[model samples]
Target: MRLFRPSRRAASLSVVLAATLLATAACSGDDAAGGSGDDVVEVNFGYIPDFNGTSLLAVAQDQGLWEKHGVEVEATSFTNGPLQIQALGTGDLDFGYIGPGAFWLPASGQAKIVAMNTLGQADRVVAQPGIDSIEDLEGKKVAIPEGTSGDMILTLALQDAGMTKDDVEIVPMEPAAIVAALSSGKVDGAGFWYPALATVKKQVPDLVELAENGDFEDTVAFPTAFVAGNDVVADDEEKVDRVLAALRDAIAYRADHMDETIELTAEFNDLPVADVRADAENVQVLDLEEIDGYTQDGTFDTWLSGMQDYFVQSGQLPEAVEPSEFYTGDLFLGAGE
Candidate 1:
């Protein structure tokens, strides 16, 4: 049996559904979280319902951290960021936990990033063992999901090797399909996120980890973050701050209780605890105090700006936008305060 959920990997979260969700968000009013009183703010939050940074939101819910911060977090499950950001833009959602699409949605004026949830450390480039380095893969076939952290990191790794996408044969495939293609040696290499990446490694132990975002820490910054509606920052900055404060509490709690964090997230995601723990080990979960260091330093800026350039180069985006066009750094800087 496969270790990961195929539903999460499937393209059920297509852009067409993003439009439909945006059009009918007003009718889907089922509540998911909150407190009894009216004074307590009700935040209808959206997230992918699986392991990964979604676990942090699970922590906040299980620990009652949202209530502690004078807000009620109503959780909604959206399979992808585009749909969530569309709902956010229409004022149906207060916030979303998302991946690389965080930058693109914001570039289009749909979302504003208030806090980062985790780094994009789980995506990796794996190849046949003999192909030792990224440079060795030039002129070879590599499969990946277009417009994801995996593709972005692979592109960066190749560029760092003094080559470009033009140097390789790019075959677009879904995560599970990439796993099969790479394992059978039908493709020279592939890029994937955890569980899928982990799956392929277990199935073929000799696969070379050609390069990942971690390899280019000096030049790349890929993060998954808590994105707010652009309108929320403009209209209800107070509520947005409250959500940030609650997330700060969750971040601190996660740092101190890794074992328990793993257990809870696995249960919340309905997966084996061991699977969730393995995935957890692959990420750098940021804490409240560390937030400033990431934002005040150039790392955060480099990540968002770099991702924009990657999107444009990949043709996922038409052109690059000023950081201000897609991001609100001030909101993230002041999230904990």
Candidate 2:
């Protein structure tokens, strides 16, 4: 999922409001740690429901990986990445999961990516079967989570099919909301990430899978990372290292126990085990080296450029901001190296 709102006009206004609030909140003291022991560093983690990062958190917590690393993590779910980054900047959260869209904000110097969590999942776009192809979406109400990676992906797919945003009516809604919207005939189609895609398709057996992330880029690689606030990483480097170590262990565990991971993820998400298994099949957990490359080689750079262009053309950003200012990769890969 994405982090920011889709309406450029709304986001611009929000950025101002968020910055003001952040400046004001900075004067207040930190909230009390969730558990005892000064040695215990509290890491507030943000997640969007049904994303791979949510499963990673469940895995890390269930295995006591954080405890082994001498850290205590408090997981929080967010509606999108921009809000996640906002919370990170304000110190409400220390770290969290964000898709490529959120990565743009940091790649442009708005935030930071501490760890690359999941990659290569073919997040799919499902439409009612009769809709058939992208061209069919024109004039139809397409439901998407506004300002997310999914929305951008959908937009790109439409462009590939010789269509543009102007060709279709875009309805902004959450991933969960898409299922009902589609079923009730409120929308002709929707773009969603895993578990929700599975759930929605199951409910609407006639759903058509119009496109996948891989089809757009052909790399089978899209990044969903563990991002930390700049202040949090700088102020508590040791804690950040410990968190990365725990996450690395969790990824290793997930690689070794597919069935167990799937079942646990399903339990944590309260979804059917089969659906979790299907979602897991699409997800490719990354090792540290691969994650590092994503940041270093400008994979994120290209994606951010696309987003910025989309925002600019759509009038989201007041003016183009340098993408480099938003991303920082210096802190990752050290723990598992």
Candidate 3:
């Protein structure tokens, strides 16, 4: 399922809901991290409720690394990307661990990606019986979230298969609905990232994974990145640095405590520990070198440009945005400080 950018409809809806969020924020007491010291910074962190970079944030919270770094993290969990983007736009969330939508949303002028959180094999396509491969997908109904990573995955998959959107019937579905649709036989297959991908695999034993985001030739990394709201990064850049530092510590903690990290992911996502561990093995927490490569080697720009082209071609995005404008590695550069 796609962790998508906000559609026109969702954007319009956010305008009405944003007022409620503002009131809620106002009534929720001090927005600052719960301390009086100048060194202390309050950070409202957001993440998807799954086994992605959120697990790293869980490690940070569990290890008290955020506090140790002089930042108080008030963590909030959302189920998907668009909601997280909406929260960022409404000033309700300052930081997020998000999927490809992270860049696209920011390209739409909502937030800014500060660091690569986890980048590896995450997005997947599960096909039902008779759909043995991407080639078998022709004429079948395939579900994907438009204007998001899932859409890009499908496009790449089709390219790999020597097919195009016209070769299959594409159905737009949300991440939560994709599994249900597939299980109920409403769609022949679906594309999404985990823990939803893991969820569907657990629930639908017969479904076979046809492809993963890593399977793509050009775009091998399926990244869930750390992003700061535009205002948040502008107002207190140091806090952004602190948050990245805490996450770096958390990633190290995850490396040393794999079993515990898997357990936390399983419990938080309500999945079997085995599934969590299996999925975790496929995801690589981005290190400084790899993260730097994305910025310096023009890999991110190439991928983003390709993604924007697909979005525009598919009619999901009205126009393309340049990747270099919204992506950054500055916070990550200062993370060790």
lDDT tens per residue, model 1, 1-337: 7695546435566656887987566333322223334547888998875565577788887898876666877788875566777798788998887777346767656678787777667778888879988888888999987656677778777777888888889998866688898778899987667766667777788888877667877755777888888778889977887788778788889888888888888877788888888887777877766766767775677777777777777677787767765566676667546
Alpha carbon lDDT at 145, candidate 3: 73
Residue runs of model 1 more than 4 Å from their true location after superposition: 1-36, 49-51, 74-83, 86-93, 100-102, 128-141, 180-186, 296-299, 306-325, 332-337
Candidate lDDT values, in order: 0.75, 0.71, 0.73
Candidate 2 per-residue lDDT, tens place, 93-188, comes to: 888778765555665565677666776465666688688898898899888887667776776688789888889888889766887887666788
Which has the better TM-score: candidate 1, or candidate 3?
Answer: 3
Query: What are the per-model C-alpha RMSD values against the true structure?
Result: 16.3, 17.7, 16.6
Runs in model 3 deviating more than 4 A are 1-39, 267-271, 292-324
Candidate 1 residue 232 Cα shift, in angstroms, is 2.8
Q: Residue 284: error of model 2 in Å?
A: 2.1
lDDT of 3 by residue, 170-236 (tens): 9988777897887777899877766566667666777878888667646444567777778887887
Whole-structure CA lDDT of model 3: 0.73
C-alpha positional error of residue 169 in candidate 1 after TM-score superposition, expressed in Å: 3.4
Candidate 2 TM-score, C-alpha based: 0.77
**Candidate 1 pairs with clashing backbones:** none
